[model samples]
Target: MRTSSTIRTRVTVKRTTRAAAALAAGALALSLTACGDDDKGDDSGDKGGGTKQPGVSVTLPKLDGESLSVAAVWTGTEQKNFKQVLTEFEKRTGAKVTFVPAQDPIINFLGSKIAGGAPPDVAMLPQPGAIKQAVDKGWAKPLGAEATKELGENYSQGWQGIGKVGGKQYGVYYKAANKSLIWYNARVFENAGAAEPKTWDELLNTAQMVYDSGVTPFSVGGADGWTLTDWFENVYLSQAGPEKYDQLAQHKIKWTDPSVKEALTTLAEIWGKKDFVAGGASGALQTEFPASVTQAFTGGDQPKAGMVYEGDFAQVNIGETKAKVGTDAKVFPFPAVGDTAPVVSGGDAAVILKDSKAAQALATWLASPDAAAIQAKLGGFLSPNKSIDSSVYPNEVQKKIADALIAAGDDFRFDMSDQAPQAFGGTPGKGEWKTLQDFLKNPKDVAGAQAKLEADAAAAYGG
Candidate 1:
């Protein structure tokens, strides 16, 4: 159920068909052909001269004719934009770099390649736990001095920590997705005479008002279980705070804890509502990722639901809807469940798997503002690099997302599911996905889901 479009991040983890085909399919459309031409940099025309990008001050070792293998799950626009960065790298250092889409479960791909003795030189590891896994397995090399220095100069302390495993820096975060958004149709809210909610109670009231106005309260992609994890994570982070969030992510606390039940109960109230969900409980199982956006923002006829909860990537799909962004299509922070609004995120970390002058040079450049600014100016991207200027973002949506990410500072947490074992978070048909799907089907079974989650988590984490 992997998404078929260019959104290669956790956005479409185990996506269903409806998410792409039902709406915004073209938004995330696959780029079948290569961006063969030297397109220069982002449309900002800043890199139009084909010169090296800005903020990369380190003197790179000339690895002329040196080849490097880089792998990730990127495709379509994501791939094209990244290639532009690589193209800049090629121009700067005269190194020939090839990007290979790592087959799903990249850890295994890297594993098989390592077992065969032909692993990639550098790879963008999207799953945080996998970075830990690679480090634990001794498959990743520490970032060299140049890259480590760039990371220190450009990235925030939190971001630097994400790439660190076992007290050593092993990766650089290049692209990020702010997952704290709740996208809604302005028309729907206006029709219900509802304003944006600041607290959890207000959010619940708004949903009820929208439901009373003849539209469903939410369009949930229950079909894809990861969405459920996001729902829980946001609420849990806000309710239990970051320290407890860290404990849960590391499996230091059991899933059957009362705090776990409290979070699930909060989620169940909305997810469990009979007519509140777009396709109802059972129908939601058939509604994939993109379709959830489509159901809320679709034009003509009454929308299936009034709102959808997802990451900033929803901007691409929202733009495709008849609703106009900043007007008809609007976003609000996922309402504060506790005293504070939670901002959760996911991102890709570029790590060096094989050490070489070429790898170190490329890694160093990737951590700079120059590399991120290229994509930022192009739109539809977010980077945690502190050196990147916000004006480079093409629109308010991306800009606000980056701003929220930066403002979160010490409060922000990487996608917690991504920080856990793949068995508990990464796998699609088993573990969290299956058990959460069961929870969605029968929301009253909070105790049951808690038990199942604890059982699965215990086995996955080996405690």
Candidate 2:
């Protein structure tokens, strides 16, 4: 689901249906009166100020008396401010987009619409896993080769790899939110008699020292099923790397894997500690993640304890708090448990319902370097385009993320549950996320839960 517009605390629509309808009708009349405008050769020229150069010439299909309607699910508080981007695209391409703002659970909107045969031309899928579901159900089409070629590599690969379930691209993923960093209070480290740890051992020692000093080392709100699962996925990948994580997602690696057991046990140990997390284990399980994160940052007038591990989205969640970036809070990539290369958690790119020329045009644009830069600049989001310059980042953390992405070698990966099937359906091991959530809340039932999941997986996968 796309993060709710509620979190944005605002809304704005620049292009109304009336205006879009007029533009669509206008573009069509122009194409008909100027028949040569729709010719394949005449259309290949760049529509914008000019082609970025050396890239495939992008000529949007002559609107031919038509327009593209995009059903987008945006996250954070900045989505409402995106009318400018949409307006910019319209001006540059001479094609108008009718964008409908999906409030929340954008996946449900996409699924319901595509199933009804009234699919939106383009969709902003906040969660990659949902993209997988859309593709599996034949709700989308593989983006054309021209679109894939123009979008560059990362944006293309991110969506293509996962979007292609059996060898067809379903969507082009454009933006992503970075995960895998722990946000901590610098002052707390100074007052708690601690320093930033360089390695996993040092981190754990520091955590213990903070606890010994009568402070909470970590404040994880696991009540939201997604929050607890983030910890498990991060820990598992840190311990097992991307290969194993992918295996887990594909159901080739069982939750019974020793490494899987280790990941869960590591979380269990943390839960076993009373003050390690705010609100305790039960509180962690019941408390909402964003709210608990806020409590950790500003529980008291002087600021609560020390740290909270969360994603880049933390800014929207904690922007109003006294814990401002570069001061009360700073981030560090989750340390490698051993010799493993640090893996950053992030969203995957994907495309859906790809048959339309409008969808292809948009996908091509999204994959372009210009689109990548725009996302980094205007959207305050990460673009998978490795070719993009790191100087585009507005902050130190974002710069670090760009650098980390470049240095990741082959270890870059997304979360397992995100790569898993939706909660209600799909193949067996591919669908145990909810079960894991239940087990986390009741550790004693781990074995029973694992057995049930394994049985179900066997049945679904026909193993």
Per-model root-mean-square deviation over C-alphas: 7.7, 12.6
The collision pairs in model 1 are: 19-290, 19-291
Top TM-score prediction, candidate number: 1
Per-residue CA lDDT of model 1 for 1-463, tens digit only, reads 1221334455211111222111222221111111122334743322223243364444566667788989886765567778888887777777899988877577888999999998999888877788889899998999988899989998878789878998999989888876667888888888899887867889899999998888888998877777778888878877876678778878899888888899999988888877988878888888877778877888643688888987766665665567666767777766778756665567788889999988988899789887888877765578878778776776666665666455545435566678779888876677887888899899999999999988989999998
Once all C-alphas are superposed, what RMSD does model 1 give against the true structure?
7.7
Query: How much does candidate 2 score in TM-score?
Result: 0.77
Candidate 1 versus the native: TM-score?
0.85
- lDDT (Cα, 0-100) at 307 in candidate 2: 79
Model 2 misplaced stretches (Cα beyond 4 Å): 1-67, 81-84, 98-108, 115-117, 126-129, 153-160, 241-246, 299-301, 348-350, 378-380, 407-411, 424-431, 452-463
Model 2 Cα lDDT, one tens digit per residue, 127-241: 5566766776777677787776765455435334644556666656555554555767666776678876645677788888877767788877555455555666666766775
For model 2, how big is the CA root-mean-square deviation?
12.6
> Top model by lDDT, which number?
1
Give candidate 1 misplaced runs (Cα > 4 Å). Answer: 1-61
Candidate 1, poorest ten consecutive residues by summed lDDT:
27-36
